[model samples]
Target: MPLADAGLTAWSWNPLTDIQVMWSYPFMVNAFRAGAVIAVLSAAVGWFVVLRRQTFAAHTLAVVGFPGASGAVLVGVASGYGYFAFCLAAAVVIAMLPGAGQGHGEESALIGTVQAFLLACGFLFVALYKGFLGGVDALLFGSFLGIGDGQVVLLAVVAVVVLAVLAAVGRPLLFASVDPSVAAARALPVRALSVVFLVLLGAATAEASQITGSLLVFALLVMPPATAQLLSPRAAVSLPLGMLIGLAVTWLGLTAAYYSPYPVGFFVTTFAFAAYVLARAARTAATAFGARGPRPGTGATGGTPHAVEEAAA
Candidate 1:
């Protein structure tokens, strides 16, 4: 059945029919596949990103790629690869910056400076090759309908490499993130780890930018991990759970966008935002109503033997 016959139209009331329709199309299948890969990678890296307080860096990388991708399109180059390369280079430079903390204002200042220059270069490239404007726009905003088999394979490869690196260094990364002073004292190669993680983050951002658009990649990367933190601060439990949530939101967003008039990026972002809000609310409620007791050895309710004996005897 063709996508049209399967109810890909915006007005389709039967979700089952819409899903059937979308599944029948190879492009839609590939889009969802790509989304799943991006989601997993984003969530995993994002967990560390939140722990390290690098949300600004993630957001900056997403936006900075806009000009690189646009410039590639204008110059008749492979825009995806160009954007990835540019982002990786930028990540290296940012990681190398001297002792500058990842403060929001400072990060934003650096990112804004880089973004302004890239945007200008992007515009210049577009002007030199006016015919490719539509292609550039599509890359910037995203077009799930345009994703091909080649892009899917590229995303898969990137995802696999990133996950492998993340797993290999997972323990040290956590240690450094939670308590850098102790990690450094142990001579754990903290700086090298930070550099490596930033590179991997750059790769993840590049992959996510393809599906979520450069502007909204942060939605999937930052939001899901932040949400997971709210629900459970323990890295052991929250890490895997966060990835699951990210994957679920991506799949849901893609499905919803396939049948609705809205763009896929919009749906994906909306789902991420909603998840964050819901998780925060649950956390707040739990904190308000959950367990509470006096300190041990300081009160009648303390867990001392006398208290236990008095209560029981």
Candidate 2:
């Protein structure tokens, strides 16, 4: 069934009227509720993902969800269960795989190995299935259709649990992410924190995959947090900034997809990428302009190492 029915009106000059029309539909309402939950959780967890430089691990967990959903279908089970089970399981495996204090090369290799294996398994499941996988496109690219009240409530509950846990560990996780050595020296449970964060990340990834799909989860998972970081240095500012950006892109993507004959993931990913690019350009322009300005305590006008760091910082 079409998310926006034929009876729905086209875009109008009045934004309020347009929104009212969109909200009048049950599917659109559920979609917005689910999207809001996913965006907030993804943004919150993803900020830590970027801060810890664990984008690879996050990507791997996202990929794991595809196999989970496919395998669930192979066994005649609900895909949602498969998504969460596989993602959370993969997260645990990744966490226990000797990552802390390990070389980046080793960590990346391990993560890549898991991602490749799971993705291959996903294809194998698809091949083995006798029935047509009609929802494959929706599984991979996402759709605003079929988001019912139950899914929205489930997503909201999961989001609340994830957010609460994150809040409890927020300070230590931030410290450990910024400087693990010092955090460990201070007797903080750096390893434990890492594991907890990974599990949370996995859950968030699974939830996000339902809306943005396994491939494009990064639209919400990485882009908004990254853009927010580019715009702000302080953790306090960047974390909430990322959440707002996630909400905006998600809502806009849903609205646009509802009106057009396109997938929600594409709109979400494009808007996120555009935001990241704009933030990058603005930061670059500011840095360049600062580089040309006269330095304080010295009359020389040029980009110095300290000057550049100061401007960029």
Q: What's model 1's TM-score?
A: 0.85
Residue 246's C-alpha lDDT in candidate 2?
98
How many residue pairs clash (N, CA or C atoms closer than 3 angstroms) in each of the candidate models, in the order given? 0, 0
Error of 2 at 117 (Å): 3.4
Highest TM-score among the candidates is held by which one? 2
Question: Candidate 2 at 274: error in angstroms?
Answer: 0.3
Cα lDDT of all candidates, in order?
0.76, 0.83
**Colliding pairs, model 2:** none
RMSD of each: 7.0, 5.1
Q: Write the per-residue lDDT of candidate 1 for residues 88-199, one digit (tens) a residue.
A: 8878887898553365555667657767777777667766776766655556656577678887898899889889999999999999988999999999999999999999
lDDT score for candidate 1 against the true structure: 0.76
| Count of clashes in candidate 2 | 0
